[model samples]
Target chain A: MALIRKKIVVKNKQGLHARPAALFVQVANKFDSRITVSNDKEEVNGKSIMGILMLGAEKGTLIVIEADGEDAHSAISELEKIISAEEEK
Target chain B: MIELKGIAAASGISIGPAYKIGKEELVIEREPIKEQDIPIQIQLFEESLIKTRREIIELQKRIGLEMGQEEAEIFDAHLLVLEDRMLIEEVISRLKKEKVNVAYIFSGVLKKYIDVFSKIEDEYLKERIADINDVGKRILRHLLGKEKKSLGDLKEKVIVVAHDLSPSDTAAMHKQLVSAFVTDIGGKTSHTAIMAKSLEIPAVVGVEEATVKIKPSDLLIVDGNKGIVIIDPDEKTLQIYGQEEERLKGIAQRFLSVKDAPAATIDGRTIDIYANIEFPDEVPSVKLHGAMGIGLYRTEFFYMNRKDLPLEEEHYQAYKYVAEEMKPYSVIIRTLDLGGDKFLSQFEIPSEMQPFLGWRAIRFCLARPDIFKLQLRAILRASVHGNLKLMYPMISGIEELEQANRILEEAKEELRNKGIPFNNDIPVGAMIEVPSAAMTADILAKQADFFSIGTNDLIQYSLAVDRVNEKVAYLYEPAHPAVLRLIKNIIDAAHNAHIKVGMCGEMAGEPSFALMLLGLGLDEFSMPPQVIPELKYIIRCVTFKQAQEIAHQALMLSTGREVEEFSHAKLNEVLK
Candidate 1:
């Protein structure tokens, strides 16, 4: 198994808040990859809406997304689309 | 002629037999049980849980179809908390270890959760504690084999007297069969008060000991406009009220005859009569009352009673639903006016000595642009569905108005970039409620497209009287000279700026204030839908000239008492 890692700045205005966090978890759960998102200090499961919200990733915050599985590449790219996309989902 | 004074929750007169609804006081007694019966007790708890789950699911579906899907999702969260493994495990462990009854053990565990959740700083988590308590109560009811009492199927039309009514109870009631409502608790803005106004029933709330004093089947007369309730009246009092009721019924009939007529004065002055609503479900009533449009569609209810903030899609759907329903007619949706007296469980609002004067309405929204922008974006998106306009509540100055407009522009830009459809030319307005806002109407009128006077807050703020406080409630005078001058100033300022002004507060619905407002140059009158017909009848009967003369005289009065007396006398004389 190969591990993929990506660091991205939260671009959406609301950060990883309610609606945005819900969308992030929905996209993260679509792939078979085991995904984890972390700010500098703590790591949380990317597929859990509650976990993602607890990360408190506001706009301009730096966070890292890591995935390990057969579909790690797709999961990372899709998750990044939601996080970096300027328009809210 | 015993008269009990309370808050005038809703307008109109209702005389009927009292129908007392006793509160459901479910007593849970702690009892020791045999250790060997632990398995049976656990089985009983499981069965009750399953039953409660089924009931919640049914309620969710019904509420979704009746209200909106967003509202229905609250039940989904309730279900999740109901099925929480930690809660269930704790209850079972306590039951087994303590060797107590399942009902007692379950309540103990539920209390612990509620206590801890209530202390949390997060408003959302604190709100979720209510869901847990609701679920716990349901399980206890089932465990005790008590049937839930509902007001859905009443056989007679009577005046309902109770301590207080929950939102769900009001929703489940057969509104048509209720002639009036008298409660032991609640103030002007309470759920019961709002519901009574929307349902078009006479109500007097905050009548302490109403449920206890009024026996079932006791003859009662409820004067909602005066906030008076008479129980078991004598012959003379009954005769007087009987004649009054008959006269009111005759007036209502005459009003209905001209329901579809345009609200134009005999002198050819036209006035737009609109309706104020809190729920999307009230749109039908707005139209039924022959309203020209919705002047104030409150958006606060969407933010209430839940753990999570409403998503943009939810706001869009609710706004779109109201706009689409009132096609060709304007729907002025106000932004979230939370905080102060109307606190959201989802936010941690520090307790204030005077909440009404604290951080509230537009102030709260401005502080949290992220939440405010989400709502603005939703309203803009729904603007394309119909004639949708948006307004900001509790805007006290030009700076707040400018800042709100700037954020609105940003929301519009966001939508434009995403290629989402919206009415770019939607009119923006500000509510002239605070005394400062009324005083600065000229400055605000320059930046805002329109103004709607919210007299409820205006009166309270000007008089420095809390409408909810019984001791000082009498000082919350709507006919005060200061309030009248402020209203006149706002209307004059808006007109001078070439913008239309309207009133959508309780003052707009008061019969005595109708002619005064019309004469004061109010372009529109938006009130509870039920009062539209009668107010329209008043408009049609009087000439604009007569109203202007009466208003002029009232403005010269020295005291609120004089103003009230003059208006009352003039109303009777002119209507006759």
Candidate 2:
């Protein structure tokens, strides 16, 4: 199993707010990897809505998204797109 | 016919088929399961999760069809919460070790998540706590086998029976579909009771086992005035209540007939008749009931029923709406009286032994000037909209009053520095709720622009009786000699200082108490909007001189019961 971690800056105006967090959880569930996201200080399960919401990442907040499994690379790339997007998809 | 005794929460009578709402099952009963039942408990947990997922998916589809896709998207988060492996695994693992019912185990796990999310200061995360709680409740409900019906989905008019209704639950009710309601718990001052009064519907509360005793389509007769509910009544009993209901309807019409007239005595003494509102939305009803203005606009609702602190703009808009609506008339806004029986998770107020006597009301505001001045600034900004007044609750002496004013001055200076225009001379009042405040009313009134007696707290403090405690509720009499003396002292002091004194308490809305209060020379009377018409009718029928005579006789009575009976007789005589 491959473990991958990437420190990505949240560029969305609202950061990883409700819509972004929900979208992230949906994408995270598709992978066999165990995903965790942290705002440097406090980390939460990237796949758990409650945990992802607990990070409360605002715009310009730096978060580290970690995925550990065979599909870890694809999970990080997919989530990175949503978090770095300027507007909510 | 089975008769259930309850507290008469609202007046009048109604007969209808009972429509019971399955209890949402927030409180779970922990049944210790045998070791052999572990597999069964595990199966129950899995089944409930599946049921909750199906329910959410079905609801989402329906909402998508009805309210559109955007609104339906909120449920996407709920579905993920149900699928959260960490949460589900924790519950299943805990159940096997603890060997308890799955419903109880699920509630404990749910509470843990809610508590964790609630502690975080982030606003976005705070709102998700509600979603977590909502999904958790649905799962718990299924585990306990409750197929609940939403209050909004009533097809026919029926008497609503429940364990209790929250403010939001009552808000969801359609007035026409809900002819009346009877709850298993809650007292006279509960929000359910208050909503029933405002809805102009009959209700009986505090009926033990009301939900269990009355079944759906059981044919219930709710006698709200007498605090009685007859389940499946006989022909003779039904006929009696049917006529009694009509007689009450006629009386209600008479009360409504006096709606437009000012509440003035026969001898030309006009008192300011006002309504006490909890929400800004109650403004239209205030006018419909012929209230001169809003006397007490309890601002705690801005804090309650929500996560995170309210922005200054939100407070300003609410105050501005009420101020403009009641333009040329006064709207007294009592600032955040947060922590007495109100669970304020936002403040994280340290749990106290005696919350009422402990750090509460003005004390909480004084300690947190950041929160206090935020509200004060909003009130000041809104004051320019129309006639608006602000009052400080639980001010015991001149020191607290002076301290509050000092903060008020800082708020004013901030506005001045920002060059924001507000009414510079907004009437600042003191609420005489504490015993010390009542005693020192003369001193406080010297600086206060007005005085509003909050008899609910005043009586509780003076008599040393917890109003919520049933055992001491008998001791919590408004007509108690000590309470009357304090009120008399307060009114006398306010008048002595040339400031108008009003009463915005349970005592203010009551007919006999209103009669006694008028004689006591109270300049204003404020109560719930629904009570305004009857009070106005009573005021118009009697001369001020006669009320003074009744008050004089009541003052002479030694016991509270005697004073109550004497004043009640005087009120009946005036109405006759």
Candidate 3:
């Protein structure tokens, strides 16, 4: 299992809502790995656009992205790019 | 002709066939499923989800092709909702546990999700509840094998009839194809009114059973000027309305000529003409109509059309934008006046026997200082942007006025501690809507810097008549002896107390009532921007002395009908 976990400060001004959240979910769905994202208290399936949005992570919010399975490394990197990019990827 | 009455929302007359919009409520009863049927139920849910997804994509593609991609992007949120793994899994899990029909379980789960989202304080997420509800309805319709009508993709112009038009429904409306709107439930300040005014279309709301009475394509006459909708009018009546519509167009052109003139009586008494705006989008139109200032900048929109309470910054930003836009002219904002006919589910405002007489306006604000002070603080912060003033609506007496001011002071103190600069001496006013407030105008005027008579509620409170009830609509007369007497006393009290009195109501905008109100020494008149030029024309045409004389004669007459007739006659005579 190529499990990967990394933390990143939300760089996009709109946090993970709108186009950014959609893009993150779309990328997460492409992975053959189980992906999850967590704020401080709760973790949710990274493949859910609603879950990402329901987190209500504003700009500068610290979130951890975790992926478990063979393509975990790639999924983590791709999802991380969405939240880290100042503009939509 | 069968006539039904409602509150006059946006004024004008339109003759068109009816297009009834039925209430979109799908009742679902839980039916037990056997253990063997669990897989079948799951399949049903999955198929409906797939169907809903395809329908949304088709709609998105069509809307993109027709209205451009920017407008079609609103459905992106809906698509996310349909594909939400968390939501779908929860429904399937609950369906197995509950052993209930898939449709019932699906709708129930959707309700829970909606509850969770609505409870979220984030404004962006709060806005998403509309999308969720929209998508939820689509999925349920598919599961139940039912189809419901939506206000979408209209082929021709028609008068829309509905039980109630929600914020989203109004937003989804084909503005060009809908000639007018008639709804079963809503007051003058409801969504229908706000949308109708912004759309510059005629609408009659609170016409009970309008959706029931008018069939699709029924020939109709919607006289928003009188708040009456006639279904299946005969030849003569239709001809009369057709001529009246033409005449009004001519009058509109005539009014445009004097739009830029100051509203002054021939005998030299000047009345400040202002616009009553619900939101900032109307500011440009307010200027076009030559309003000297914004007299009643209603802040209720913050609470309306959404689930969560707006953040203080939202209020501050909007108020600041309007205040900056109307720099020299004063903007009088009426604070959050919830309850009564316009109650929010978020507040859990109870159904009252007489909502208008129950907890509302300043009463509701006084009880909820946490909510009230947040708004007050925002208003205070935005006060520095221009000539901004604030007023409390439905203030019945001195106690409510003082309590409200005490909270305002607390807001000021909070701002002061933060070193936020605001207009320290911002003028504070109290809206005289209740009879008690009108009777004690002198006492209120002591603490109040000014008074804006909200004649809509004043006439309702004075006559003890429910404004929305068509059976008693005749009793809800603005020119009733009791109503006029209360108004006279209020104006007199404000003048005696050295505070100016203005009116922001339907009565203030009516051309027939303009002269009498001028005679009563109303210092200001605020209404929908479209009515400003017409009222200004009436004010400019008559001498204040002549108006006073008309007022004197009209007051001597006992009935509201007589007073109205006299005012109409005098208006025609002055124009001649």
Candidate 4:
């Protein structure tokens, strides 16, 4: 088992919200890692759409992503890719 | 005849029998149930929730296929609220503890949520309260064993009289069968009103007791242009309205004959006729009414009724749809003209004492470059699809126009750097709505490619009259000497700068004012698509010389009344 953590700024126009948030959760759920995302104070399960939405992370906000499991690194990177992508899906 | 006054929601004249849409009242009574019956009550509630979910899914699918995916996404919120565990569990808890009927407990829980949601200071949250209420009402209706009434299968042409029409109700209406809409409650910007305008139907909303006084099959006359509804007219009144109706139809018929003809005066001076549209769906009406192009494609609607800001892709798709649909005809997509009277729930703007004069339109956009640049990039990308032009709204002076253009250049540069394909030569225009903008139009025109006089705001701002305020609304006059002078000044400035000027406002749509505007040297007239044909008819009937005389006389007039009287007489004389 491995633990990975990364801090990233939300670069997408709408931040980690709405469709982007759903995409993040979808990517986070693909691995068996325990993934969690947090802003300044609030931490939410990265695999839950509602939890990610409740974070209210708007564009340019600093967020922390953590994943712990065998595939933690890939999960964290894939989830980061979804949030940092500039163009809308 | 009994005349009822209301807000003029849509402009048209419709005379027909009243078709009253009776709203079914849901009767919820608290009946204490036995302990054994509690499980059955809970079962009933669950069944109703399932039923409501199914109905919403069906509506979402239908609206997605018909309107757009964004519009259908409104139901996604509804579905989310419906499946919310907190709300359902609260209702169930109340039913168990209070030992009351499911309907009563559910209503109480729904009301609590509505009250809490409504109290939120955020406008987006406030708007979402409507969705919660809508979903709650659907479940309540099912729990009470009542079916929601629909206006889908209207049998004949009739004037629909209702208390108020919900968005879903208006969406479900048989547009062809309903000749007009007269509602008991709604302002000019209400959902019903916007829907009426989009459907191209006569609508008189905010007429309190319209549903009470009007009966089914009662003869009704809805004068949407004047916001008056006449019910059960006398023979003399009927004769008068009958003649008026025939005259309007005759105008429509006469205009249709010249639909394919160019908008040229008797002396062969050509003037462009265009349509002012709020949605891409209106492009067909623009073509059907013989509009050469869309002069003002208001992009504000893209920012409406949603929590999230519109993505660049959404804006691009909308502009591309209109541009491709119009093909050879140009589509002028105006930037997001939010703030003031048209506040977006997504934008948290502080309430201003005088909103009309407050931070609005281009000022708001300039302050938020991120949002403004997104829209600009979308418009630029879409421009390559057709003859698309972009414009800014409420630009007060040269500085604002320059700043807006600077932002546009930045957006273009970003797209270029990204290797995105866009029309680099897209024409840019600015709206002269503020008195300051109209006064310094020449200086502003030097920076912009063209000018559009938005007379609705111009008249309101110039005269210092809040058009929405019924008491001072009469002071907002388009024919006022000062207004005319400002319009003339704007046109002269634009022309002197070698830029074409157009008017896309209520003043341009007015037939009596057509000669005056033409005489003022307006190169184009853009108005509601429905009025384009009549304006074209007026333009073709009069010569440039005649219009010039009318304009000169109008400028010399002392009062708005005198200008109105003179323009009316001259208009009838020239056209008749």
Candidate 5:
């Protein structure tokens, strides 16, 4: 399976912090796909809360996310949309 | 037949049926499942999680629509915690290991997390745990075969009796049905408390066990003035409370009608009464209360209520709006006072042991010259439309005052170089809330065009007691001999320099203290817009000479308690 990956800058004022990261996870859980997000040095299950929190992606911090599944293409696109939308507020 | 006492959070009372929000309990029937049925239970749990997640999001959006974003953030955080894989996977792992039904396992795991968060010290952040587990329980119930999670209809004009209300719970409450609230958990500064008061709903918080004893739709009376809750009250008791409500309401209406009336005493003393506004929407409330101007226009609301720093244009619009509305009336705008409990997203400062005594207010502004200059430029531009005066908060010494003035001077020079037209004649002032500022008021007063007493922080820092702490709340008496002496000292210092001094704290709104303030020779009194009429009535009935006499007598008392008792007694004697 091919894994789609990208690093995005958090544009929201509170950082990609707790609430927004949780929101990203909730949106990621929608599709029947396996997703993982990583900061510079660590990788975590996108659906795992401790993993997202451990990522600690603050405002202006670049975060790399990866998705691997039959639906990885659609999942990566959706995940990118969630982070870039600036609508979590 | 029983009476319960609580802290009087707000003034007024209501006699109505008790409307309990009731804890959001999971009510699902569980049946024994064979070991082979574990897979089916797991699938059901997944389905329920999806549906519950959607419902929780919808509820969160609804709350955001109702109460605004700051409150939405509270539930939004809870929603994240609810979806935590750590929590969900932990339950799933237990289900697989124990070979038990998913519903029982989920319920137990949710209970464990709730226990953990309930023990936290910070009340603001601790309330989030209740919200998180509440949604978790709802999901578990759905998996166990419960189809509905609905609270029965509330009575008309009810007072919601609860242990405490989450931000989500309070947001969902029907304002038409729920006229007031009496809760076991919360204080005046609690999020729910601030919400209730902001909505003008009579709320009495910190009533222990109010939800447990008061039955649903039971006739109840909530006395916010006296901090008493009466359950199943007799006819006479109900009538007395009803009459009192009517009287207070009549007074309120009368005040509303004359809110725009010029504030003048019967003895013909015209005192400039202004409103202390936190937001721009509150600008109209100032006019409704007949404020001659906007006294303490708190710019912090813009910083505190949102996630992002307000842009220069956004700041200009808000300042311009109030300045335009109050056209000829002076709108005293304080520069962005960030620090203490109030934080801004733009400034990066380390958290301190004593934030009130740390790099906050004018200190933060002075440190970031560009940020400080941007606000100064905005205020100056807004001043062109109205009588605008810029003030700085928490000024301790003349050096800080001079340093701040230097930045303002630099802003003016830049604007001048750019050929931008701003009100160059705008008056600058400082808040004399710190003891050092008060002690050296003569020096600071010379630098400042005027002085406003921020008594809330003044009393807190002076007495070293957080007014919110129940243990030391009694020490929060504003009329403490030391506090009164400080006020007298500041006024004397300001008057000596021909500078105006005003009060912009809770004490300014209180009727009894208005007389004492005038007696203390305060040139101005800035309070909440709603309190202007009552204070005006009190001010008109008494003369400055009489107030001075009573205030003089009060200052002679030995202890804080004696001063309070004597002042209360003397106020009644004079006002009558």
Candidate 6:
């Protein structure tokens, strides 16, 4: 199995702050694959709220995500979709 | 006795032994006992398990009666964990194998499991550890041969000093004995704060390490206004505070006596006074505080404290209750002012560069027509019970007002087609809370049947300051010249269009700004009901002409301090 890891750019103005982080987490939980997020060198469990909060990645920062398990491809696609979608009203 | 001080979370106090929640170290002390004593320890542990399960049910039942069903469920889950055979079997095995007393064994087994749940990152789930430990402590108290702590056990009034307090723990406290609460964690909008505020208890939170210094029976004084907890206050100081507390109680009673009286000037220029309520349960408080009606009935509270969206009937029942209570008085309902600091977890709103400035208030409602229409239909249906006016928040221009009006028209049409009984001529209004909305007041006034100045958001938005951010919080001044001018302009436009304008924000209750608002020609004032009598007194003391002169002087002041100074001097000059 080929494992893909990449840093997705956050484009929203408020950055990966409260609202967006909540969105990111909710989207990440929709998949069955195991996912982890890393900022610079530190990596945390994607499902762990503290890990996502500790990143404190602002707008325009790069976050690397690694996925494994059966739905890695699909999970990555969903996460990317959430990161790029317009702010939900 | 050890002494510690923390931010007051609830008012009324009691003196008792240090009931440290989340702190328990079990001592076996079995060197003097023989191997045959193990059976006694096991039997004691079994009895404690049964006692704890029964106590949990009692606590859950009491809390269910005091707070509600949902908060009671948190304790119910703890009861389930206590009754689990796996935990009981593990503890029984430990007592026999290690020759430890049942008390020590219970703590050891419970601690291991509690640690596992506490390490979880989910805040909601992590909070469950507090509940479990709460249950564990009850059982330990019985096993360790400690007396059951009851609220009635407190001999005198004392402040509760704790590292942290959960809602259930607070709900279990005696209202008469618990004078005030001091906690080491939680913010102004946390569950602790909300509960305290609802109970009208003076509470200060976020004082870290408060539980380390304050001790039981230390004669502490929690000055909630100053956010200061004075440990071991001298007799003289305590006497002074006691007298002051009594005096304030007398004044509060005086205010209550005039709560139902009409809000009118001494010369009889009657002005409408309304309450800003978030829940249907608070409607009685509005009447108790002498509110003629509800001005800003925020519908968000109905949406909050629930897992899913409220069905139309649930919404209808709440709205109808408040509307029926108000009767002939107008109940202005502001539809779901959600977003910004408050976000719904069930759904996600895309992050914006500026949520306050971008897609929020009416903008979000316009985009999600289904959610907006559901609320509209609910409001319309409730209108049949009493006079209820529907208002839109954050209207910046004529386009937004027209879009919202279009929706209201469609909602009305739907109700009419269904033959539902609703007030077809019910007044629809717009909130002049944004600088843009206030600036374009003339255009908005032409479209909106009424205008209400939401001064809290208006000041924050007008100054480009976030009130929650302490660094820029000083910038939040309702008396700022720009804010005053915007208010004046909006009032003028509304009056010119022959439309009634009212205010339902912090400014409505502030005595310093009462004269200025009246001078600007506001038709109504709405605030927390407790403030109505005092504002009415201020209004009755001065005439419209005198208030105009004060308003003119306040507007000329460049800084907030100057405006405040000017308002005080003018009020004293006129009243005296």
What tens digits encode model 6's per-residue C-alpha lDDT throughout B1-576?
223444455553322233333334445444334589988877887788788787778876876565545456556456555655457777878777887667777787787776755554544444445556677777878887787444445555566666667654676677666666677876654556656665666666677777776655556666666566666666776777677677666655655566667766665767888888887867766777678889999977665423367788888898899889889888999987877655454445665666677777788899988888888999999999999998998888999889988888898899999999898888999999989889899988888899999998999988999776679988898888899999999999998999999998899888778888887788899998767887776787777777777788788878988998888777666545
The residue ranges of model 3 lying beyond 4 angstroms of the native Cα positions read A1-89, B1-249, B305-307, B348-351
Poorly placed runs, candidate 4 (over 4 Å): A1-89, B1-40, B53-91, B104-141, B144-244, B255-261, B278-289, B300-315, B336-375, B394-419, B434-440, B443-445, B460-474, B572-576
TM-score of 4: 0.66
Task: For candidate 2, write residues B1-576 as lDDT tens digits.
Answer: 999999999987999999887765466888999999999989988998898888788877765544344445567777889998778888889998998999988899888778876776655565566567767877877888886556888889999998877543554566689999899977786656766876778899999999998888999999988999999999999999999888888877888898889889999999999999977767887887799999999988787533368999999999999999999999999988877655453555554667778898899999999999999999999999999999999888899899999999999999999999999999999999999999999999898999999999999999999887778889989999999999999999999989999999899999888889999999999998878999998888889998888788888899999999988888777776
lDDT of 1 by residue, B379-452 (tens): 99999899999999999899999999999999999999999988889999999999999999999999999999
Task: Kindly report which residue stretches of model 6 are placed more than 4 angstroms away from their true locations once superposed.
Answer: A1-89, B1-106, B109-136, B139-147, B155-170, B178-247, B301-311, B344-349, B468-471, B530-546, B565-576
Candidate 4 residue pairs in backbone clash: none
| DockQ per candidate | 0.03, 0.11, 0.13, 0.04, 0.14, 0.10
What interface root-mean-square deviation (Å) does model 5 yield? Answer: 9.0
Cα misplacement distance, residue A3 of candidate 4 (Å): 32
lDDT of 5 by residue, B1-576 (tens): 889988777667787888777666665444567778878878888898888778777876875555544556566665666667777788778877787678778777776756654554444334445566557666766776666433235446788877777664666566677767888877776656766765666888888888888888888888888888898998899888889889877766765655666666656677888888877866765776678888899887666423356777878888999999998989899897887766444344554667677888888888888888889988987778889999999999999999999999998898899998889989999998898898999999889999999999899988898665578898898888889999999999999999999889888887767777888888889987768877776676677788888789888887878876776776677544
| Local lDDT at B421 for model 2 | 93
lDDT of 3 by residue, A1-89 (tens): 88888999997766776567776787788788988899997798898877787676888999999999998976776666567655431
Kindly list the per-residue Cα lDDT of model 3 for residues B445-523, writing each as its tens digit. 8999999999999998888887777689888888999999999999999999999999998899898999999998999
> Taking the tens digit of each residue's C-alpha lDDT, what string does model 4 give over A6-56?
999997666665456655765576789989889898887776644565676
Query: What would the per-residue lDDT of candidate 4 be over residues B428-535, giving only the tens digit for each residue?
Result: 999999999999887897788999999999999899888877699778888999999999999999989999999898999998999999988999998987787778
Whose DockQ is greatest here?
5
Full-model lDDT for every candidate = 0.83, 0.85, 0.85, 0.83, 0.76, 0.73
lDDT of 1 at B237: 88
True contacts kept of each: 0.00, 0.26, 0.34, 0.00, 0.29, 0.00
The deviation in Å at residue B83 for candidate 4 is: 8.6
lDDT, candidate 6, at B215: 59
Local error of candidate 4 at residue B203 (angstroms): 7.2
Model 2: pairs clashing at backbone N, Cα or C within 3 Å: none
